[model samples]
Target: MDTLMPADDLTDELRAISAVVATLEHAQQNELPDEFAGLFRHDAIWTTGGGRRLLGRDAISAFTHQVLPGAMAASTATYEVEHVVFIRPDVVAVKVRQTPVGRDGVPLPGVNPGSPTYVMAKEDGRWLLVAAQNTEVVDG
Candidate 1:
């Protein structure tokens, strides 16, 4: 097994994770990615809001292209990074909230002002999300 890397090496990974989150938030709230090269691991997996399961980058990217624009068309996404923990030097877990907007600029249906848990891993100095699942907390 690979020895755990140092904490300092985690910065780049963290930055990459942040970039992915930012890009995803951007993609979710207003637009979609024309391609899915840098944002996700080639083998990434995601669980949709409606509980549909999608595996692999191509499937996820295709799902994004088909779904996001109509479901989340408003350009108003707010994000909050709740926690970042180092499970190992190459692995980190993040909790965050990505707010979405309605067509009238109001918060959208099924999108509460809350958070979700995301798991990201550093691979060859690049952080890519391996898994992302939702939090059960309701917007208060």
Candidate 2:
């Protein structure tokens, strides 16, 4: 068995991964389905916070385009990168915190937060989302 050691470019890799999450937040807030869809790999799988499972980039793109328009009329979301674990030199698992916010940036009322985990791979010097699962945190 071998231990997972931190690579010398860990900081740079984290920045790159975090940029992806930032782009996600921006795309969602602006209702840009195409931009959001571009983040994923062609064969990626995604399970939404509402428990909808999407397979492949085309499916994800269709779903996003279908539901993303005007979805932010009342509120949008902010995504923050919480953790990044390097699965290998070219792969990573990223944890993100999602909060629904109003136009003024305040947290929206009666809206639960979301926790999303993104698995990404470095392809051609760019990080692409491979698989992602978004879960909503409900208060008990």
Candidate 3:
């Protein structure tokens, strides 16, 4: 079996991913669909906050351009990856927490801390999100 990557290398990779997340955050904040769409693959599928699924480059772009900006109107959405494990140099799985700010720039309720496992890959030296799914955390 192959051993895990070194801590330093993992840290660097995660940092690169963090930068990609930051870039997406900025594009969403600025309502830049073109820039946002540029971050993902043409055939990528995205799960929306409202429980809808978006597929294909055109659909994904349209969905974001139509819905996300309004849902997050005058708001900001930021995320932090809680954990990242590299399966290979090109593939990583990540657990992330998303926080959305209200129109007043205050954190909103029902933003209920959620977790999503993301599969990311480095394409042409840029980290891109390829696949992801939200994890439900139920407490009894």
Top lDDT: which candidate number?
A: 2
Off by over 4 Å in 3: 1-6, 103-105, 134-140
Q: Please give the range of 10 consecutive residues that has the lowest summed lDDT in model 2.
A: 1-10
Q: After superposition, how far is residue 49 of candidate 2 from its true place, in Å?
A: 0.9
**Model 1 segments more than 4 A misplaced:** 1-13, 35-37, 102-111
Estimated TM-score per prediction?
0.74, 0.93, 0.79
Candidate models: Cα lDDT each: 0.68, 0.91, 0.72
lDDT of 3 by residue, 2-56 (tens): 4277778767777899887777777877778877877777777778655677777
Kindly give the number of clashing pairs for every candidate. Answer: 0, 0, 0
130 in model 2: Cα distance from truth in Å? Answer: 0.7
Model 1: how far residue 131 lies from native, Å: 0.5
TM-score of 2: 0.93
**In model 2, how large is the Cα lDDT of residue 22?**
94
After TM-score superposition, what is the CA distance of residue 28 in candidate 3 from its true location, in Å? 2.4
Candidate 1 residue pairs in backbone clash? none
- Across residues 1-140, which tens digit of lDDT does each residue of candidate 2 receive? 12264654676777889999999999999999999999999999999988999999999999999999999998899999987877887898889999989988999889899999999999999999999999988981
